[model samples]
Target: MHDDAHAAGVTRAGAAFAARRAELRMTVQDVVDSGALSKSALVNFENGRTWPRDGNRDKLERLVGLEEGALTSLYEQGAGMSRQDQTEGLVRAGAAFAKRRDDLNITQVEVAEQKIMSVQALIAFEKGRSWPREMRRAELERLVRWPPGTLASLRNAAATPSPDLDGVSAEPPADPSTLMLDAVKLALTSALDKLKALPADDAPTFIAEARPVMASLRSLQALASRAVRANIGSVSAVQTLEDITACFEDLMGRVAAHPAASLGQKLYVARRKRHLNVQEVADILDMPATTVAAVEADEQELSDDYRERVEQLIRTLTFLKL
Candidate 1:
C-alpha cells in the first residue's frame, strides 16, 4: 500500500491544485488567461471531474510545481488504472472497448478501415486522451456491443462531484429522466456554443438534446404548415399567442421536472400549479421575497439546514398538489 502522504495527494489532487492556486492568488480566469488552458478543460480538471489531456497535463504540472508526470501519476493512482486507461471516467469504458476489440483479434487499423473513425482518433479514444462527440461515442459503444448509455454512465460517474469538495452543492438527486435532461442540457449547450466551428451535417445530432430550441423550431414549422393548409390566409394573432403560450408552458413543465432546474424553477412551477402567487409561497415558507427570488435565480446556494427547510416545504406542497 502507498504511504499516507502519497495516498492523500493522489486522492485529493483537485484539492491540492486548488490550494496551490490559492497560494499563488490565482483565480480560474487567471490560469485560463495565460493561454495555457481552455476554460472548459481547466474547470473540469480542477474540479476533479476529468483528466487533463497531454499538453494541458504538462502545463498544469509546471504551473503547480509538480515534477514531470507527477500529476499524471497522482491521477492514475487515484483512478486505480494504468496510464492507458486513466482517462477521466473513460477508464472502464475504454478498457472494455479495447478488450472487446482484442478478443475478436481486431486491429485498430482494421476498425478504422471500417470507416468508423480515423486510426489516430481510435488510438486517442482507446488511450482515454480524448472523447468522441456524442454521435461517435454512441457508434463506438454500439460497435463494442455495449448497451446504449453505458459509456455515458461511466463518464457521469467520473464527473460526479465529491461530497467533500467545498463550495460545491447538491440537491436530492432526481429521477433518471431528469438526470438525462440535465446531461442533455450541458452537452447540447456546449456544442451549440461552438456551432460555427462545426460542419452543417453535425448540427442535426445536437438538435435532439436541445429540447427548448427544438420546441420553438417545431412551433414555427407547425405555423408554416397551418398557413400552407389555409392557402396563405392571414394568421390570427390571438391563436398565435395561445399556441406560443402553450409551447412555453409545456417547456416550463418539462424544465421543472428536470433535476438540473434551479430550485427556483421547481418552486415557481409548484406554486403556479397550485394557482398560488410567489408571495403566497414565500409567506408559507416564511422566507423573504428577496430570498425566494434569489433562490429561484440560483443567485444563492443555501446552507444545509435552510435548504432542508425549503425542501420540506416543497415536499409538503407537492404532497398537497400545491
Candidate 2:
C-alpha cells in the first residue's frame, strides 16, 4: 500500500512539475542555470523517471514560486489517498484524541481557547485536513491530556500499515472522577472565598458557614473514590483524582499559602493562571472592576481583610487542575 501510493505521488509530482514549468515558458537548462537543480536530476524528475530528494524538491518548489509542501500536497492528492491515510498511526492517534475529548465532554472551542489557536485551524487539524506546527501540536496534545509526543509517534509510523484495531477500543473508559476534577476545584475555590470573607475572630461562625462546603467536597471525594475502586476508568486518572481529593481534604482546615513577594504580583499570576481577565474576576468576586485593576496594579491600598481574602482565593486558584 505504501509503495504504490509513493510511486503514484512521484509520477503525479513529475507531471505537475513539467506542466508548471511549461506554463511559465521555462526550459530544463533554464532551471539548472538558475541553480535550483542539476541537469540530470531535473531531467529525471520531469520525465517521471525519478523523484527529487528533499533539497532538490525544495529548490524546485522555490523555482516555481510554490509554497513549501505545495508540490507534496499535489503528490498526496494524486496518490488517491490523503496524507492522513498514508499515516494511519497519526489517524489512530487523532481518533484517540477525539475520543478522549468527547469522553471529557470538552468542546472544541474550549480546546482551541486553551491551545491558543483559531477554532477553524483546530478543527482542520482534528479532521486531518491539515497538520499543525510542532508547538501547536504539543499544545493540542496537552489540551487532550496526553503525554508529549504520544501523537507524534505517528510520524514515525507513516510508511507502515495501520495497526490492528479489533482488539483495541478507540473510546476507552475514562475515569469519571477525572471529569469532576475541574468542577471540584472551582467549588473548593468558591468555598475558600467564603471562608476568607468571615472574620478571623469568629471561629463558630466560620465553622457553621464552612460546614456545607466541606460536606460537598466530602461527597465529591467519596464519589471519585468509588469510581476508582469500581475500575470505571484509567488507573492514572483514578490515582490523580485520589491524590487531589486527599490534598483538598488536608487543605480544608489549613490557611492560605504565602502570596507572591508583592500583593499585585500574586493577584496578577492568579488571574492569568485561571485565564480570567480583571473584569471577569471582579464580576465573579462582586468587586468593582476599577478596584480589581487598582489592586492588581498596586496603585491602591487594600484593607487587610480584603487582601487576606484575595490571598486565600489565590491559594485556592493555585490548586486548580490545569
Candidate 3:
C-alpha cells in the first residue's frame, strides 16, 4: 500500500515536470548536455522513479524557467498524499505536547537549555514538521508529565484505522498564527525572567547577561510585527512586545552609563553597533564563530591570549565609529 502511494506521488510530480519540460521545447538530452543536471537523475525524476534533491531541483527549475521552489512545492503536495495519516498522528501528538507545556508554563528556551533539544528542533516538532527520535520523544513525554508511551500510543492510534465511527469529533489543528503567538509569548516570558534575575550591583556581569536577552527581545518584536502584518496576529501582542522593548532599552541605557562594563561587553556592543554578525567577526579575528558567541554571551571565559586580539578588534571598531 505504501509503495502504491509513493508511486502515485512520484508519478504526479514527474508528470508535472515532464509537462513543463515539454512545454519549454526541451528534451532530456538538452537538459543533461547543459551540465547542470545528470542524465540518470533527470531520467529518474521524469520517469516517476525518484524525487530530486534540493540542488537538482533548483538547477532544473532555472534550466526550465520555473520559479524557485515551484516544482518542489508541487512535489511536496504530491508526496504529502502518502503521509496524510502519519501527518495527522504527528499533529495530534504535537498538539498534546504543546497543551501540556502551556499548562506548566514551561518555556521552549528552558527546555532547550536543559539539553532536551534545540529551540529550532522543538519548534519543528511542535509544528509537526518532523518527529523526534525515541529517546528525545521519551524525554519530552517525561518533561511534559505525560505517562510513558503516551506519545507512542497517540501516534499508533493515528496510524491505525478505526471502526464504528460514531460521535467522534476530531479537533482542528492549530493554525500558524496561534503557534507563532505561543512562541512569542514563551520567548518573551523567558527574556523577562532573565531580565529579572540580572545582578543589580554587578555592572559588567549585568551587561554581558543582558546583551543576549536584548537580542532575544528584538527578535521576538520582529516576529510579532511580521505576524501582525500578515493579519494573523493581534496588535496587542505587538504592543506588549514593544512596551517591553522600550523598558528594556531604558534599563540598558542606564547600564550603559556605567563605566565598568567588561571587555566582552564592549566587544559585543561594538559588534552589534557595526551590524556585524558572529561569523563575520569570527572571520575577521580568525576565531571560531562558536568561540565568539561564547565570549559575547559570557558562557566562556576569554583567555588572556585572546585579550590582545579582542582589544585590537575593539580599536578597529572604534576607528570605524562603531
Candidate 4:
C-alpha cells in the first residue's frame, strides 16, 4: 500500500513536469540535447516511473526554469510517510490554530498588527507552507490564546521520523561550500527573474540594478573557477557555477543592447566590469565621491566641467585595459 502511494505521488509530479515542458514549448529531444537527461530517462521521468537523482534533478529544474526543489517537494509528497505525513500533521495543527482564532473573533491582521508576524507570513503559517521561527513561535501561541508550549509541541510531533525507527539511513550533512554554491544559484536565478520583469523604457533603472548583479556574479564565478582548478569541489558544483555564469552573460547581452540606456548608466556598467569601486574611480578622476555617485545615478544634467572629468575618467579606464 505504501509503495502504491509513493508511485502515485511520483506520477503526479511527473505529470506536472511534463506539463511545464509542454508549456515552455520544449521537446523531449531538446531536453536530451541539453544533456539534462537521456532520452530513455526523460521518458521514464515524464511517465512517472522514476525520480531523477539529486544532481540530474537540479539540472532538470534549471532547464525547465522551475524554482529549486519544485519537483522534489512534489515527489516527497508520496515517497514516504516521513515528510508527507509530517507536513499533513503540521497543516492540521495550523488549521486548529486558525479555528481557535476565528472562535475568538480575531482577524489575521489584528494578530499580525500585534507584531507576531506580518500578514503574509502568518498566512503562510496558517496555510502550513512554513512554521514560525523558534523566537516567534511562543508569541504566536500566546496571541492565539494557546498554552505556552503548544506550538513547540506541535512542531515536535510533526518532526521527521527517526532513522532508527524507519530503518532508513540518515543522509549526511551537506558540505559548506556546496551549500554556499546552492545559495549563489538561487540568488542568480532571482536576479534573472527581476531582470526579465524590467520594462525597456526604464533602461537606466534596469542597468543600474543589473550592474551590481553582474559584479556579484563575476565575483562568484571567479571563486568557483578557483575551486574547480584546485579540485576543491564536486563536479556538480563546478557545472552549476558554469550554468549560472552562462545565464548571467545571456541576460547581460540582452540588456546591453537596450538603446535607451543613458551614457551615465553605460559608464557605470563599464566601471563595474573593470572591477573598480566608485571611490576608486572618483580618486582617479580627481572628483568627489558624491560627484561620481551623482553621475551614476543619472538624475541631473552634468555641468561641462563635470562632463569633461567624467569623459577623462572613461578614457583612463579604457587606456589602462581595466
TM of each candidate vs. truth: 0.28, 0.27, 0.35, 0.29
Q: How close is candidate 4 to the true structure, as a TM-score?
A: 0.29
Task: Show model 3 residue runs off by greater than 4 Å.
Answer: 1-169, 182-260
Q: lDDT scores for all predictions?
A: 0.54, 0.58, 0.65, 0.63
The candidate, 2 or 3, that scores higher on TM-score is 3
Across residues 156-231, which tens digit of lDDT does each residue of candidate 1 receive? 3443345655654576555543343343334334334543333333344332243324333233333333333443
Per-residue CA lDDT of candidate 2, range 159-184, in tens? 33355677687787665455555444
Worst 10 residues of 2 by lDDT: 251-260
Model 3 TM-score (2 dp):
0.35
RMSD versus native structure for model 4: 15.5
- Report how far off residue 284 is in candidate 1 (Å): 1.0
Better of 1 and 2 by TM-score: 1
Candidates 3 and 4: which is better by lDDT? Answer: 3
| Displacement of the residue 4 alpha carbon in candidate 4, Å | 57
